[model samples]
Target chain A: MTASVTSLVNQPYKYGFVTDIESDTIPAGLSEDVIRLISAKKNEPDFMLEFRLKAYRQWLKMDEPTWAEVGYAKIDYQKIVYYSAPKQQKKLNSLDEVDPTLLETFEKLGIPLSEQKRLSNVAVDAIFDSVSVATTFREQLFEVGVIFCSISEAMREYPELIQKYLGSVVPVGDNFFAALNAAVFTDGSFVYIPKGVACPMELSTYFRINNGDSGQFERTLIVAEEGSSVSYLEGCTAPMFDTNQLHAAVVELVALDHADIKYSTVQNWYAGDANGKGGIYNFVTKRGLCQGVNSKISWTQVETGSAITWKYPSCVLVGDNSVGEFYSVALTNNMQQADTGTKMVHVGKNTRSTIISKGISAGKSENSYRGLVKIGPKADGARNYSQCDSMLIGDTAGANTFPYIQVQNNTARVEHEASTSKIGEDQLFFFRQRGISAEDAISMMISGFCKDVFSQLPMEFAVEADRLLALKLEGSVG
Target chain B: MISENSPIILSVNNLTANVNGTQILKGMNLEIKAGEIHAIMGPNGSGKSTFSKVLAGHPAYDVTGGEVQFLGQNLLELEPEDRARSGVFLAFQYPLEIPGVSNLDFLRVAYNSRQKHQGLEELDAFDFDELVQQKLDIVKMDAAFLNRSVNEGFSGGEKKRNEILQMALLEPKLGILDETDSGLDIDALKIVADGVNQLSNPDNATLMITHYQRLLNYVVPDYVHVMANGRIIRSGTKDLALELEARGYDWVLDEAAAGVA
Candidate 1:
C-alpha cells in the first residue's frame, strides 16, 4: 500500500496542458522601462503609474528573504516575463463576444464563465494570464450597488474608491513578494460592498496561468463599508512546464464599522512532477483589517498544490469588540514543501481571535505551520486561541509547527495547542481489519483530521475542499 | 463438543512468523470449528497476540512459513480487508483510537463494506443508523458513544465493549477476541462475556485468547489449548483450563517437554 501511495502521488499533473493562443507578452526582464511598459499597456491613470513606480523602486532595494523553511533554486528575475495576456477582442461586451478558445479553456477548467450556464449562486471573474477575460453576474451585483470588476477597470471607472482603499491594509512595500506584486501586478478582482447592503451572491475569481515563463502577479483588493458584508472566493491553476514559474500575489481586505468580510481560497496550482521537476512557486501575501468597531474578518483556505508555497494570510484587529478568524488546511505530497499559516495582531480592547491550522504531509514532502498572536499593551481585554495539528502519512514525510505569542497586556488571555501524529501501521491495520480499503482509510483519516478547518468554509467551498483533499491524498497510505 | 459432523472454520498448520527480523511465531498450529468456543491460555511472550495478528494479516508480521485455511479457502492469499470482508474478525487486544472519525460513521463504513462484499445492497445512513442502534444493545453501549470519535477518550472497558459492538454489527462467521478481558473489571468482564455469549450461534465460532481462567468461568470454552514458545503444546477439554489454572503454566510446559522427550 505504501508503494501504491508513492506511485499515486507520482501521477502526472492533470492541469498541465497549455492552451494554444496568441499572447502579447512583454520582453523578459525587470526594469523601470518594463514596469512603465506594463503600466502603459493597461492604460492606467497617473496615480496608478506613480504607485507602480514607487513599488518598483522599493522592490529593487529589497532582497528575497530565506527565512521560510523551504529550499529552491534561486529565481532569475531577468529571465522572467513580467506581463503576458492572450490577444483577443479588446473589449468584450458579453460572454458571446469571448473568444471560443478562451471560453473552452474555462469550460475545460470546470469554471462556467457564462451567467446562464453557471449552476451555483456564484459570480465568477475569470482571469487568464494577466487580464480578466470575463466576469459573470455583473448586472445582478451592479443592481444592488455593489462594485465588482477587474482592478484595472475599477481604476478607470471608480478611481476614487481604488485610490482610497488600495494598499490601505497591506502596504506596497510590506514584504519581498508583496512589493513585487505591487510593482507589476497586471489585473485581479476588485470588490466594494456598499453600506448596509449584503452582497447577494458569493463573489469568486478563477486565475489561470497559460503562457510559459511568465510570472503572474495579480492584485486583489476588497473593501466592505459600514454595515456591509460579503464572502469572496479565489481559485488558481497553472499549466505544466519544464521550467519553474513564479506566482507572487497580494490580496488586501478591509471591513468598516459593523461590517464583515469572509475570504476563502482553494489553491490548486500545478505542483511540479513527483521528482520536483517543474511547478508554480506560490509566494502570496494576504491580510485583512478590521478597521472599525464591531467589524469582523475571517479567512479559510485549503492549499494542496504548488511545488513550494510560502504564504501567511493574517488579520489585524484594529476595532474594539471586533473578531478575527483563520482556518487553514495545507497538504503536501511527493516533493512539495509548504510553509503557511496566519498571524493575528490585536490592537483593540476586547477583541477576539481564533486560529486553527491542519497540515498533512505525505511521501517525502515537508509541511510546516508558522503562526503568531500579538496583543498590544492597550488591548487590555483581548483574547486569542490557536490550535495547530500536523499528520504525517508515511515515515519519509515531515511536519513542523512554530508558534510565537507576544502579550503586552496583563489582562489578555492567549492559549496555543499543538500536536504531531503519524498515520502509523496500527491505525491502518485497524481500518483494514474493518474492511476499509487503504485509500479510503487514508482519505477518511485525513478528512477527520481536517474537519475543524473544513467546517469554516462555505457550503460549496467546503464540499470542494473535502473532495480536493481526498484526491490529493489518494493512495497515500497503506 | 467437538462433534464429528461439525465444520472447520479455521485451520492453521506450521505457521512461522517474524517481526522486525525477530522470530515471534515458531511453527504455531491450531484448529477451530463452527459452534465451538476455544480458549488459548499462555504466559507472557508466548506469541498469543502475535498469533491473532498473523491471522488478521497484519503487515508488520512476516510469515516465513504458514498455511491458513478459512472456510476451505487459502486465507493467507487474501488481503487484510478481504480477510475481514470474508467474515474473519479479530477484536484487537489494543483497539486504536482514531480521532475525528465518529463511531457511527466508522461502524457504518465497516458494516457497509461487509454488506457490499456479500453482494447485498449497502445501507443508507438512516437505515444503517437504525441497524447500528439495535446492534449497540448487544454490548449494552450508550447511543451517545456513537457520536464520539472511535474509542477516543474511551475507558479501557469501553474500548473493549466497542470491539464487541463492532463484532455484533459485522456478525462475522469467525470471531477472535484477543485479550478482550485484559483490563476489564469483574462486572465489565461479565458484561463483555455476556455480549460475546449473545452473539455466538450455531453458525459462528469464537476464539478467546486470555491470560486468566476467570474469563472462561463466565463464557465457558468447549476446548482449551495451552500455547508455549509460539506453538500450541497441549489440548484438552474445558477441565484442562481449570487444572492448568490451579497448577500454573509451568507444570503444563514441563509435561509437554517430558512428553516430547
Candidate 2:
C-alpha cells in the first residue's frame, strides 16, 4: 500500500528540464575585479559600483555563521560563476524579440511570459539565471504610477528610488548571505506603489535557474508609499544537476504610513535526488519594514524544494500601531533539510504581530521552525501570538521548533503554541478502514494540516502549492 | 426479528486470533442471520472487542486459526479497506480524532468509495450534502458538526454520535458496534440506539459488543450471548440480558464450568 502511494507522489521534478540557450556567462571566480566587471557589464551607475564594493569588503571580513541546524560542505566562493544570462539583443521592445526557447521554457513551467498568454491579473517578471528575460504588463502598470520592472532597469530608469530603498530593510552587512547577495546580485523584480494608489493587479516574479555552474543572486525590492497597497508573489524552479547550485537572494519591502504590502512566495527549486546527491542551497534574506504609523506587512511562503533551506522572512515594525504577520508552510522530503521560520521585531507602540508556521517532514529529512519575537523597551501595548506545528510522515523523519520571545516592556503580551504529530499507522488504518486509499488519505491529511497557511496564499497559488506538497510527499510514507 | 428462512450474513467457526503473540480470541464460534441483531455481553479481557477488530481485518490482530465467512466470501483474505468496501463496518470504541479533516468531507469520501466499489456513479458535492443532511437526522446531529474536523475536540458523546453518523452514511451489511455505548450518557445512548434501529433492516445484520444492558434496553437485541474466557458459554433472548444485569456473570461462569465438568 505504501509502495503504491509512493509511486503516486514520487514523481520526478517536472520543471527540471534545461533550456538550450547560449552565451554571456562570466568566468568561475570572485574578486574585486569580478565585482567591477559585473557592475561594468550592466552599465550601472557609480553609486551602485561603490555599494557593491562596500558589501564585498564587508563579506570578506565576515565568516559564514554556523548556528543553523543544517550541515553542508564548506562553500568555495571563488569557484562560482558570478553572472550568467542568455545572450540577447541589447534591449527588448516586445516579447517577440525574446528567444523562443526561453519563452517555451517559461511556458512549460506554467509561467507564460508572452503578453497574449500571460495570466490576466498578474504581471510577471520572468528571470532566467542572472537576468530578467521579460516583464509582462509594464504598460498597464505605468498608467497607475506603479513602477514595475527589473531592479537593474529600475536602477537605470528610477535611480533615485533604487538609491534610497536598495538595502534599507535588509542592509548589506546584515548577514553573511545577505552581504554576498548585495555584492553580486544581478536581476530581480522591483515594484513601487506611489502614494495612495493600490496596485492594479498582482505583481509576480518567476525565477528559473537554467545554468548549472553559476550561482543565482537576485535582489528584489518593493516599496509602498503612504495609504497604498500591493500584493506581490514569487515562484522559483531550477533544472536537475549532479552538482549543487548556490542561490543566495535578498528581498526587501518598505511600507510607509497606512500602506499594506502582502508578499507571498512558492519556492520549488530542484531538491536533488532521493539520495540527496545534488540540489540548490537556498539561503535567502527577506525582511519588511513597517516604517510609518498603521502600516502593515504580511509574508506568506510555501517552501517545498531545495536540498537545504535556511531563511527567515521577517518584519521590523517601526511605526506606531503597525501590524505584521507571517504564514509559512515548509515541506522537506528525501534527505532535504529546512530550518526556516520568521522574526517579528516590534519597536513601535501599540504594534501587533502574528506568526503561524507549519512544517512537514518525510523520508530521512529534518525540518525545523526557528522564530523570534522581540519587543523593544518603549514599545508599550505590543502583542504577539505565534503557533508552530510540525507533521512527520514516517518514523525516519524529524521535526523541531525553536521559538524565542523577548519582552522588555511590561505591557507586552506574547502567546505561543506548538505541537508535533506524525502520520501514524493507526491513522492510516482508520482511513483505509473507511475505504480511502493511502495516497488520498495522506494528501487529504496534509492539505488539512496546512490549511491555515495555504489559505493565506492567492487562490490559484494555494491550489498549486497543495499539489506541489502532495507530489513531494510521495514515496515518503514507507 | 430473525426468521428461519433468513440467509446467514456471517459464520464464524473455531475462530482463534492473536495480538502481539498473545491469543485473545480462543475457539470462538458465532453465526448471524441477515435480519437479526446479536449482542455479545462480556467482562473485561473477554475478547469481545478483539473479535470485532479481527473481523474488520485490523492490522494489530492476527487470525491465527479461523474459518470466517461473510456472505460466503473468505473475510480473512481481504484487506481492511476491502472488508469495509464489501459491507463490513466497525464503529470504533474510541473513535480516532483526525484533526483538520472536515466531517462532511470525510463522510462524502467514505460514501463515494463504497459507491465506486459497487460500480455506481459517485455523488458530487451538491447531492452528497443533501444526502448527508438526511442521514444526520437519524443520529439527531446538528448540521454544524459537519463542518468541523472529524471527531476533533468532540465530546465523548459527540464522537460516538459521529460514528453512528458514519455508519448511517456507509450503510454496511454487518455493522459492528464495538462498545459504542461505553462513553455516552442516557440521552446520547438513546439517540445512538435510535440511529442503529433506524438503519437496521431485514437485509442487513448488526453485531454489537457491549458490557452494559443499558444499550440493549433501547436497541433491544434479538439474541444476547454471554462471552467469558474467549467464547460464548450461553445464549438466550432479551431476558438473558436482564438476568445478567440483575445478577452479574458469576452465575453463568459457574454454570458453564459445571457443564464442562
Candidate 3:
C-alpha cells in the first residue's frame, strides 16, 4: 500500500504499472485461474471459489455493456489490478491500538467518532480503500447477538449466515458489472440486523479511492430479518489526480417480513478537470429486495461528482403489501456525464412504489434520467407513481429522459411524468433586476427544482447536498 | 434634453425586430418624454411587448434595423444587465420566478448594482433591509415576501406588485410597464396604478403598454400612441385613448394603413 501510493505520485496513470505490494494479483487477466487465485488468497472454501469461477466464466461470455448513456474507451481486463492489502498492520483487538492514520483519515472525512460517556453501543467498520481498517463496538454488538464486519471477515467468522443469504437476492450471474464484481471484488461491508432488533444508530461507510488505476470493487450485503429495521449511509470521495479513475461497486439488500431499510448515498468522486481531462468513472449497482410481507425499502442519493456516472440504486417489491421508494438529485457540471435513475419492480399484491428524480445539467455536461417500473401478473392492486424533471443551465448542455414501464396486470396502475427545460436567460434577468447575481440566480433555481428530493435527506445531509450543487455549478452560467 | 411637446426620454427611429426570421416589429417608431406617461395601445401582434423586450436587450429577438436612444446613448448597445444598471426597468408581462433567490437578496443585488454603476457605495444586508422595508409598504407588499423566492408562487397581483417594488428599488430613469395590468383585478390594478403613481416624477418617465383603455382610465396617460402593424400611426392626449376605446381597433387598422401608404 505504501509503495503503490508513493509510486503513483510519479508514474503516468494511463500507462499501467504494477507496483510492489503484497498483492494477491494473478496474471492480470480474468479466467478460472484468476477467480480461483482470488478466492484462495482470501482463504475462502472451495464452494465460494466455484461460484466466483462460474461468475468469471459467465462474465467472459458476456459482452461489456455498451448501453449505458456514457462514453469511454474499451476497458482492458489484463491491465486492471484485482486486489491489494495493507502490509504488516495488525488488526487490533481494542480501539486503543488501531492505526492512528486510518482513524485520522476518517476524522478528516468528518466521521463523528467518540466514545459516548454512557451510550456507545453503535458498532462501526471503517473501510479505507481496499481493506477494512477498524471495526468498532464489536464486543457490545456481539453481546446483543449482532454480527457486523467486512464481507471477507464474515466468511471466516459467520459462515453459516453468509451461506444462507449471500446469493439469494442478487445471484452470481446478475449482470455484467455484478458478475465482474463477484469475481474481482476486494472488500466491502457485511451487516446483519437480527430479527426484531432495531439498529440503535445509523451505519455509515466513508469510502475513498487513494490508489490510482486500481478500481475499488466493494460489495455490501444488508439483511434485515422479520420485524427489523436499519438505516445506512454511504459517502465516497477520492484524491485529486489528472487521470480517469474507476470505481465499480455492487450492493445488495434484503428485508424480510415487516422489516424496513433506508439507504442514502452522497457520491462526490473527483469530477475531472475543468477541461474534462481526468475524473472518476463511477459505475455502481445498488438494489434492495422487499423479501417478505409489509417490508419497506427506500433509496436517497445526491450525486455531485463523477466524470461519467451510470448508476441506479433501485428496489424490487417482492413481498405482499411492501413499499418501495427512490428519491434522487443528480447534478452534472463541466464535461461530466451522468445517466442515473431508479427501477421498481412489483411482483406481489398490493405493492406500492414512488420515485422523484431531479437532474441539473450545466456547461457542456449531459444529464439523463433512465428508469424502469414493472408490475408483474400477480401484482394485483400494485400502484406506482413517478415524477422526473430536468433543468439545463446553458444552451450547450443536454437532458434526456427514458422511462420504461412494463405492466402485465390490469389491476396494477403505473403513472409517469417527465419534463425537460432550460433556465432561460429571461429567468436570470428577472433575478438580476431583483438584486441577485447570475450565479446565485442559477443556484437558487436548481435548488428549488431539487427540493422535493433534497427534503428526503437528513437535515445536515440536505444542506450538504444543496451546497455541493452550488459548488459544482459555480461559474457554469453561460 | 427632452422638450415639452416631445418629452421624449426614449426615442426609437426606424426600429425593426424579428424572432427566428419571422418579423414582429418592422420600422416601429415611438417616443416618451420626461414626467409624462405614454400608453402604447395595439392588437395582440402589434409589437407592444416586443418593443419592451427589444428595449431591455432580449437576445432572442434580432434587432434588424434602426436604433433606440435612451437619455443620450444607444439602448441596444448595452447588455440586458447593463441596461438594467442604467435605470431602464421592464416590468415583464409574465414575470419569471427564480426560485431559491430570496426577494430581499435579489432586491439588494439590483439595488447595489445600480449604486455600484453610479460609483456609490453599496448597501449591506441590514441597511438594505431597512431601505426595502419602507419601499415595500408603498406597494402594500407583505414584509414576509422578502424571504420567499423572487416572484415564485406569487399571485398574479403579487407578481405585478413585486415588479413595481423592484422598479421602486432601482429607481430607473425609464420604466416600461409591459402589459403589467393584464392579469390584475380591479382592486389589484388600482393598487398597482397607485404604486406607479407614487413613484413617478419629472425626471423619471413611464411607458405603459396595454391592450385595453381600462388601465389607462386608472393610471391616466398624458399621450396615447396607436400602434398599427408595428408602427405608431397616431398620437394624442387622454381623449385619444377614449376615442380608440370607443371606436374599436378596426378603424385604426384601416386608417393607419392608409396613412402609411
Chain A TM-score vs. truth, each candidate: 0.98, 0.98, 0.89
Better-scoring candidate (lDDT), 1 or 2:
2
- DockQ for candidate 2: 0.65
Highest DockQ, which number? 1
User: Which portions of model 3 show Cα errors greater than 4 Å?
Assistant: A1-27, A94-125, A135-146, A240-243, A476-478, B1-88, B97-174, B181-195, B198-205, B210-214, B223-261
lDDT of 1 by residue, A111-164 (tens): 977666774688999999999998888888999999899998999999998898
Best by lDDT: 2
Give the lDDT of residue B211 in candidate 2: 96
Note each model's CA RMSD in angstroms: 1.9, 3.0, 7.6
Worst 10 residues of 3 chain B by lDDT: B1-10
Model 3: per-residue Cα lDDT over B1-261, one tens digit each: 235765457889999999879888888887778888888998888888888888887766789999899888898887677788887899989987765567887788778878998899999999999999899977899999999987888999999999999999899888999999998999999999999999998888989999999898888888889887777878888898899889998887898778769
User: What TM-score does candidate 3 reach?
Assistant: 0.77
Summarize candidate 2's per-residue lDDT along A1-478 as a digit string, tens digits.
2444445446688888899989699899999999999999999999999999999999999999898889899999989999999999997889879999999999999998887888999999999999999999999999999999999999999999999999989888999999999999999999999999999899999999999999999999999999999999999999999889999999999999999999999999999998998899999999999999999999999999999999999999999999999999999888899999999999999999999999988878899999999999989999999999998876778899999999999999999999887776677778888888777788889999999999999887889998888877654433
Question: What's the distance in Å from true for residue A339, model 3?
Answer: 2.7
- Over 4 Å off, model 1: A4-12, A475-478, B258-261
Better of 1 and 3 by DockQ: 1
